[model samples]
Target chain A: MIEIEHVSKNFGKKIVLKDVNATVRAGEIFAIIGPSGSGKSTLLRMINLLETPDGGHITLDGTDIRAGPGLTLDIRRKMAMVFQKPAAFDENVYDNIAIGLRMRHVPETEIKKKISDVLEVIGLSGYEKQRAKTLSGGEMQRVALARAMATDPAVLLMDEPTANLDPVATGAIEELVLRINREFGQTVVISTHDMLQGQRLAHRIGVLMNGIFSQVGTPREVFALPKNKDVARFVGIENIFSGRIARISGGVAEIESDGTVINAVTPLPAGTSVCACIKPEDITLHLVDGSQTSARNVLDGRVARMTAFGSVTRLVVECGIPFSVLITWKSAEEMGIAEGKPVKISFKASAVHVVEDTEVRRP
Target chain B: MGYIIDGLREAFHLIVSLDPDVMEITALSLVVSLTATCVATAIALPVGTAVKFTDFPGKKVLINLIQTLYSLPTVIVGLLVFLLITRHGSLGFTGLLFTPQAMILAQTILILPIMTGLTISALSGVDETIRDTIVSLGATRLQFLTSIVREARFAIFAAVAVGFGRAISEVGAAILVGGNIAHRTRVLTTAISLNTSQWEIGTSIALGILLLAIALVVNTGVSLFQQR
Candidate 1:
């Protein structure tokens, strides 16, 4: 396991990372999700000692990376990092992939065997003699990945490795990430600006923003329920309506807005201004039939817009306030959902989450 | 037009016949310049790469000054060497003045900046990404630098070609230090100048053709490498 504690970094009087902590278990894929300039890359670089942390220490399996007893190479050799932009050696492809193994003084026969194997794994089998400098951007990136795995590092760190790639290339890299993890059992730490990608690939995800981690959990928890307004909005929570707490009874709080009433399971007191959060996926659409169930909250609205997000479909409903619902394509097809269609959407009062209006959590 | 045609005819004949005087001059030119190029390369590459990559106060100005030396006049270099090698000058007891040794000294000094300056420029063209890749590959410092040298191979090749071109074609410096002595210190450039002064157009034109051919061959080789 790799444990990072209270790490901080600064660049020219600017706080780039503050009090950051992460725990990555062995053989698991961990992702740090953040926007641009959110210090995610800095944290990864510090783990490899490429950038020294200003305040805290990171340890891998009980050895501190900053400890003076061992050469950083001994630590670095166990961890491989693939950069955002691929940098290949000026030699041929064969020699490029052989570099890490050669550094360890691996036997020539073993180096050749390993390089040939990785070249095939990266889908560049026939390119052994081709010049690395002549490869295309995606091909060179694959070679960079191959070189990183040549020595079979115990941990792999990636910083926006697919940020510059086309979708086809991105798909291949995504598959490669899972394959390498399942096959080699290496711990992987990746940072990306794409939340959906982080959700898809990682076992656990951390949301990094403004030099602090606001939330870290399984993708389902972080996506289904955000702890605060900033995270809720940043994570693509579609409906965050301003409301005032009305009254509290039996672990449920009534929230009154401009033209609608809602209830949430919160401990906020009456007369306090708060924001009510709801995920689009949590808003389920019904046929507006007379039949009803135990769901506490329900409303009728005309579909304002319909759009497809890959396999999932999203629709905006013109209730008193606009509410968005994300549903499976099959469900949308069966319900005949389209723009301007009147439909009923409902969610339990427990689905609503409330947070104080004046709170800003920063680490 | 007739005069030019006849000169060309005689130049071709002299080249074909392999005239001993022309051969000696051409051989000496290659030997002296190639020696200087080799010696200059041994010093310039390490020095240039070090001075370029090392961070120190006034580094940019230092690089600018070294590049400025690329324009230093060859005659000024000859004058410096002439003073040092001339009789009654400092360390003049060895009598290298008016010898091939003096000519070689002048040429080495003349091309040092060309080699060093162009080397610095070539290495600076290496993307910052290359350094990060090598260092992250678990390479020792020596391995990192050696790999970079390989990456900058073409640029260094061009620098060597340019340096050798300058050395082989320099007339003023070679004449000043070697005194254009016949069959001994005479090179292609100095011999052409001497023969032209004596109204020996055939010999002068033939030597000029040979020099032009050598430059063409060197440049073509470098071009092939670049294209490849």
Candidate 2:
């Protein structure tokens, strides 16, 4: 387990991270997800001790890694880092994977056995004599992974390991990461800008924004109940309306935004200013009245725009305000959905996530 | 024109026949220069690696200074070694003046700067991420240094070759410090100088051809080694 306590870093006058804190549990994948330039790489580097924190200390298990003047080599040996760029020594694949073991003074025969095993694990068998420098980017990255795994580290730190790879290559590397974690029970801390990847791989995710973790939870919690508007937007929530609660009745609140009242289930009191958030997939579209759908909030609107993304088509419907709706391409085609087509959109009252609007308007 | 043609013909004949005097001078030149280059590489590589990894107050200026010495004049080095190893000088007790050892010492000093500077550049050419990766792999300090040096091996090899080229081709240092003593300290360059001055143009041309051939062989050897 690794614990980051109030860690901060700055380069010159630029504050890259500030008072960042998160704990990575043992034998579980912890992902740090953020937009570019949000200090995700810096945070991972700090955990690997490649970059020292400016204001905080990190601990491995219970020992403060930076406590003593010269930290023991055993502590560092327990962890290995895979960089954003694929790096290999100017040598053959066998030597590249054997380097870490040789550094630990493993015997030649044992080193050979470890190299073969790691190569098999990374699915690069029969590549021992290949020149690592001549391999493809994805192959070289796999070799880098093999190199790290040969040491049998307790913690594997990966910083956007597949960012430079193509989609097919990215999937292969992601699968390898998952397999290694599950099979070896190595604690994995990976950082990525792709939120979907975080959702797919991490047991828990930390949403880093503005140099700090804004939200930390499971994939379901983070995607469904984001702590603020920034996290909701980052997590791909497209429908958010700023409003003030007008009244509450029977554990539900009616919020008014631009003369459009939306009913949602919330414990916040009446007359509170808030923003109502809804996931695009949660809204159901109907060609006729959606009153039969048993949903609390129903809005009649015309499709303002339509955009197709692979198998799913997104429709931006303008009711009182614009609402983004995601529906299957087949459903959209069956309904003949197009721009300027009138549609009724309905969602359950419980689907609307409400949070206090803390946005400061700049004139 | 006829005399020049005759000299060329005789030079080719001497080379083909492998004249003992020419062969002996050629062998001595190889022995002296190769020895000096090996010794210089032994000293310069570690010094250059040290200068590269250590950060000091005047590191940039120090690197610039080493680079500037890459073009240091051979006569200056020859003169400096002469002053130190002459009859009454500081190192005179060792009696190294005007010997093959003095010539080797002069050539080593002549090429040390260039080799050291080139070695630093070679190490610099390695990617910055490689350094981080090595450290993250739990390498000890010694292991880290050796690994980085091994990564930059080809470039360092080129540095050593350049040092050998400079050492072998230098004339002023060989003549000044070695005195060009025949059958003793006379090498290809100094022998060529002596034969040219005495109007033995054929012998000088033969020695010059042999010198160029040696350089070509060494360069080819280094390149082939790098290719593997």
Candidate 3:
């Protein structure tokens, strides 16, 4: 297990990490998600003692890594880090993977066997003799992964490892990382700005904003029920309606604003101002003349704007309140929805998340 | 123009004939420069890498000193070594006043600064990510430095080449310390000077062309290595 206690790092007067405490249990993939400059990379470096946090302690397997200069070397062998870029040595791919093993003075025979195993694991068995610099971006990252894992580190720390690769490479790396986690039982801690990747790979996600971790939980909990407005917006909350609580119906809270009543599943305190949020994909589009749907919230308006995004179309319906709706291209074609066309948008009250408003919750 | 044509003809003839005097001088030049460069590299690489990778007290001063000496005059270095190795000088006990070893010692002084300066530039040119990745892989300090040197191999190669070129081309230091002996210590640069003094244009021009070829080879080899 890796434990960080009250770690704070600073460069000159600018504080990069401020009094952070976190833990990574063995054999779990814990991901840190945040915007740019949120100190996630710096935090990852501290774990390997690369950046050396100006204050606080980082311990790997109950040993303080920053005890002194030589203290980091022995403990760091148990933890290996891969950067956003592969940073492969200008050697052949086989040597690149065998470096950590060679450093540990492993015998030549075992080194060859271990390197071959890692190369096959990362799907680069035939690339052993190729120059590392000649490999593609994705291939280089795979080599970096192989090199780190060749040591059989107890903890593998990655900072945006897939941020530089294409979607196909990203998928491969994600799968390989998952396999490493499952097969080798290596604890993985990765930081990324890609929310989809974070949701897909991470068992638990830590949300960091402005040098502080705002929330740490399962992806479903963090995405569906964010702790605050910042987390909600960062997670791509597209619909935010400013409204005042009007009344509470059974399993529904009605929020009135600008001559429209919005129904939310979660109750809010009465007479309190609140913002209602819903994802664009969550708002369903229906024809103006279609049968009345079972969704709790529906708004009737003309199609204020329509934008096609390859496979899906985004529609902005301007009723008493503006609503953003996502529909498939085939559905949009069937409905004949276009700019200036009339349409009705509907979604369940549960899809409308009452956020940061006491009025939207029950007293 | 007539003298120049005659000189070129005689220079080519001397080169083809494998003149004993000219060959001895060329061989001495190669040996002395190679020795000096090897010694300077032995000291400069670790020192330069340490300077580049770590911050310590008086680092700026040391860097400044190296930069200053990088442009040091060959004659001034000869004068210093002359003063040190002459009788009554500090290291005079070994009687190295007029020997190839003394010449190598002088040239080593001249080349050490260039080697150190170029080494600093080479190691510093290495991408920071290379060092960070090696460190993250749990390499010890010595292993880290070794990896960095390997990553900056081309630059370090250039540094060595420059040092060799500087040492081989130097005339003042070798002439002063080695005394430019007939066959033992007479290098190509000193032979050129002696031939010019004696009006032996054929031998001097031949050795001069040979020296230019060596320098050209060194420069081109370094450039090609860096390109690769």
Candidate 4:
């Protein structure tokens, strides 16, 4: 397990991370998701002691790495990191992977076997003699991954491994990540800005925002129950509205935004300004006036727009406050949902998670 | 004007027939310059690698200073060596003023800065990712540097060649500290300077040809290595 305690870092007056803490257990795939420049890379670097923290300590399996022992190489070799860029050495695939094993003094036959095995795992077998620089970006990143896993470290840290890859390549890498985690049972911590990728790959997820982990839990917990408005925004909550609480009773509050009143379950005092977050997938749209369901909030409005979004269609309905709903195109055609058509959008009161804006606003 | 062609003809004659006098001077020059370059590289490589891999206050200023010294005038270096080994000067007890040792010392000093500056540039030009990947791959500090040396081997070999070229072609320092003594401390550069001053045009041109041949060999090797 890796323990990060009160880790803080800064460059000049710009704070990259502040008082961040998290524990990554062994054999679990952990994903850290955040916006760009949100200290995701910095936190991964701190774990390997590549960048020392400004304030706190990180312990690996019980050893305080920052202490004065100087077995830093042994500690570093215990884990491996793959950078966003394809950082292969100026050599062929065989030599590039062999270097890490050689550093550990692995025997020659074992090193050759390990290189071939890692290449097979990365699906680039028989490319031993190819110069790594001549390969394409996706291929080179795979070679870099093979090199990282060649030594079989106890923990694997990858920073945005599939940031700009095509979908086919992204799917390949995600499958590889799952295989490594399941087969080797080596702890994995991957940093990504894609929430869907985080949800798909991570056993546990950490929402890193403004140098702080605002929430850490399973993917379902983070996606459905974000702790703050900022975390919700980062985790793809498109329907966020701000309003003052108008009525509060029995653990529910009615908030008014853009002349639309919304009822959310929260214990906040009435008249306090708060933001309501609702997932786009949570709001269901129907073409009829059938509001006879268990839902507590329903609005009647004209369909503002509908567009095909990959596997799902994104439909927006305007009822004073526009709400975005994601449904399959099959349902869109069956219900005859289209632009300028009157439709009804409904979601449960429990689906509306409320959060106060604690971050300072820029003028 | 006719003497230019005649000098070239005589140079070929001396080189082809391997005249004993010219051959001895050629052999001594090769030995001295080769020793000085090899020794300087042994000293400079580590210094350059240290500067590349470690952080220190005023490191940039120091690097710039070393670069400026790369074009330092050889006569000033000769004068410094002269003062150091003169009879009235500091280390005159061993009588190394006008010997092959003094010439080697001067040539070593002349090429040290070149070797160090070019080495730093070569190693620094290596991809920054190499360091990060090596360390993350579990390399100790020493192992990390060994990996860098192997990665930057081509550029480093070029730097050594450039240093050797500079050392072998230098005349000012060699002349002042070696006194151009025949069959003793005379090298190609110093002997060429002497023959040129005395209007021994044929002999000087012959020595110049030899010096150019040595430099060509170094540069040819450099270009071929860089192509890899």
Candidate 5:
């Protein structure tokens, strides 16, 4: 387990990370998800001691890694990092993969055995004699991964490893990451700006923004219930409305926004100012008014704009304020959905996640 | 034109026959300049690596200063060494003036700046990501430095070749420091100078061809090393 406590870092005057805290559990894939320049890479570098934190401490397996040079090396050797840019030393594949093992003074025979095993794992067997610099980008990245895996580090940290790869290459690297984690159970921490990747691979995801983890939870929790507007938007939550609770009865609360009342399940008291967040996928659209459904909240609106993205169509519905809704292309074709078409949108009260309004808005 | 053709023919004959006098001067030139190049590389690589890795005040300025000295005049180096080893100078006790050792010393000094400056460039040419990978792979400080140096081996070899080319082709330093003493301190460049002054065009042409041939061999060797 790696514990990052209140870590802070700055480059000259620009604060890269600020009072960040997160814990990576053993044998679980923890992913840092954020937009570009959100400090995900900086956080990963700090965990590996590549970039020292200006404040706070990072501990590996309950030992403070920054205590001294001796301890830092010991801690660092237990971890391996693959950077976004694939880099290989100017050497043959076998020697490149053997570098870490040789640094530890592993016997030559054992190093050879490890190299063969790792090459097989990365699907580059029989490439031992090939110069690493001569490989294609994807092949070189695999070699880098193989090089790191040869050491069998307890923690494998990857910072946007597939960021520069094409889609097919990205899939291959993702598969390798999953296989390594499942087969070896090495604690893995990967940072990516691809939210879907974080959702696909990580056991837990940390939503990083403004140099701090705004929310850290299971992928489902973070995707469904982001902590704030920034995270909500980052996680692809498009329907967020500023409102105040008009009344609370039983377990449901009625929130008023833009002259419309929205029913959601929240324990916040009446008159509490909040923002109601909803995922675009959760809201269903019907052409007819009052279509039979068990959903609690229904709003009548007109499609203000329509944009097609591959198989799905995104509709901007202006009920009182704009609410973004996603529907399948076939459904849209069947209903003849178009701009200025009147539509009814319905969603469950539980689907409306409520967070207390923390951001001050200007009039 | 007839005399020039005769000189070329005589030069060809002298090389093909491997005349004892020309061969001795060629061999001494090789020994002195090669030794100077070896000595300069040994000292320059470490100094250059140190400058590349460490952060200190005036580091950029120091690098600029070293680069500016890349064109340092050989005669200026000769004069400087001459004063240092003159009877009343600081290094006079060693009696190195007007000797082969003094020539070697002068050539070493003459090439040190270019070698050191190019060594630094060779090291800097290594990608920063490679350094990160080395450290992340658990390399100790020594191992990291060694790995980086190995990565830059080809460029460093080229730097050494350039230093040798400069050292072997220089005339003023050898003439001033060694006094061009025939069959003793005399080397290729000094011998070429003396032969030209005395109108011994054939001997000068032969020595000039030999110097170019040495440079060609050194460059070819460096290219072959790079290929490997």
Candidate 6:
């Protein structure tokens, strides 16, 4: 387990990280999601002492690394980091994978066996002698992974590991990460801006903003109960409406937005202005009377735009509030949804998430 | 124009014939320069690695000091060493004033800064990722530097070659300190200078051409090593 205390850092006059605290448990994939320049990478670097914190300490396995004696190579052996850009040494593939083991004084025979094993694990068995500079971007990242895993580190810190790869390559890397965690039981703390990737990979996710972790929970918990508007927006909540509460009802609040009353799952005091969020997938598109669906909130509108998003077609229903719904291509065809056609959009009240009232809006 | 062609022909003739005087001077130059370059490299490599790897107060000043030494007048260094090794100077009892060892010592001083500065720049210019990866893999500080130096072997070799080239072509320091004694302390450059002063243009020009050719060969070898 790794525990981060109140770690704060300042670069000259600019504060990179304010009092940030978090804990990463063993054998779980923890993901940190944030926008650019939000100190996510800096926070990850603190775990390995690549970047030291100015204010507080970090502990691994209950030992305070920052306060203890100079962290020898022994301490480094326990944790490894994979950078956003794969930083492989200018050597052949075998040498790159063998370097960490060689540093640990692993014998020549063992080094050879470990390099072969790691290369095989990364699915590059026969590429031992290939120069790292000649490999493609994806292959190079795999080499970086192999090098880190060759030492069998207890913890792996990753910074936007797949942000540079294409979708197929990203998917492959994500699968590899999942396999590594499950097979080896190595704790992983990965930072990324791709919310969808976070949802797919993270057992638990933390949302960081302004050098502060606003919320931390499982993927479902975060999406269902985002602590604030920023997290809701960050988690791909498409239908975020800002309005003042018109009335408080039985376990629900009627919010007035753009001269229309909207119902949210959470109760709020009357006259209080707040933000309400709904996932694009949570909204249902149906070609029927507004009263047919079991959904509580129904709006009638014309189909302002339709786009064929891969694996799902996105329909923008220009109604009281322009609501976007993602449905499969088959469903879009079954409903005969197209641009300029009138349709009814409905969403369950339970799916409507209410967030904090802040001038910093997110959609 | 006639002198130039005649000089070129005589230079080729002396090289082909391996004249005894020419051979002795060439051999002395090779021995002294080789010793100086090896000794200087032995000292400079560690200093360069330290300068690049460690950060301390006055580090930049020390680097600048080395650069300053690189441009120091050879005659001034020659005079300084000459005074130190002279009979009347400090530690002058050993009588090293007019020996080939004195010439080597002077040339080593002249080229130490070249080796150190070039090595420092070469090692420092490598990819930072290489260092990060080595550290991430649990390498000790010393192991990390060793790995870096291994990867930077080509550049370090080039640095040594540069130092050797500078040491071999040096005339002022060797002549002043070694007294340019014949059949013993006279290296290629010293012999060229002495023979030219005596108006022995053919021999002087021949030795100068040979020295230039040797310098080119050394530089070519350095570049080839770098390519690998």
Find the candidate with the highest lDDT and give its number: 5
The collision pairs in model 4 are: none
lDDT of 1 by residue, A251-318 (tens): 78888876777778887888888889987877889876746857777888889999998789988898
- Winner on lDDT between 1 and 2 is 2
lDDT of 6 by residue, A218-259 (tens): 999887889888888788787888887888888788888787
Superposition error at B87 for model 6 (Å): 3.3
What is the alpha-carbon lDDT for the whole of candidate 1? 0.87
Q: What is the lDDT of residue A302 in candidate 5?
A: 98
Q: What is model 5's interface RMSD?
A: 0.7
Off by over 4 Å in 6: A70-72, A166-169, A267-271, A284-295, A299-346, A358-363, B197-201
Interface RMSD per candidate: 1.4, 0.8, 1.0, 1.0, 0.7, 1.3
Residue B48's C-alpha lDDT in candidate 4?
94
Q: Lowest summed-lDDT stretch of 10 residues in model 3 chain A?
A: A354-363
Q: What does DockQ come to for candidate 6?
A: 0.56
lDDT of 2 at A141: 92
Classified by CAPRI criteria, candidate 1 counts as medium
lDDT of 2 by residue, A208-290 (tens): 99989999999999999998889999999999888889999989999998888889998899988888999888999999644
Each model's fnat? 0.48, 0.76, 0.81, 0.83, 0.62, 0.69
| TM-score result, candidate 5 | 0.93
Candidate 5, what DockQ?
0.68
Every model's TM-score = 0.90, 0.93, 0.92, 0.87, 0.93, 0.89
Stretches > 4 Å off in candidate 1: A256-260, A267-273, A284-295, A299-320, A325-345, A355-363
Would you list the C-alpha lDDT of every candidate in the order shown?
0.87, 0.91, 0.87, 0.88, 0.92, 0.85
Compared with the true structure, what per-residue lDDT tens digits does model 3 show for residues B1-228? Answer: 776677789999988998777778888899999999999999999889888989899999999999999889998999999999999899999899989999989999898988998999988888777788888887887888898899889889989998998899989898888898898889999988998898888788898899999999888888887666
- The digit string of per-residue lDDT tens for model 5 on A84-151 reads 99888889999999999999999999999999999999899999999899998788889989988988
Q: Score the docking of each candidate (DockQ).
A: 0.61, 0.73, 0.77, 0.61, 0.68, 0.56
> Which whole-number lDDT from 0 to 100 does residue B130 have in model 2?
89
| Total clashing pairs for each candidate | 0, 0, 7, 0, 0, 0
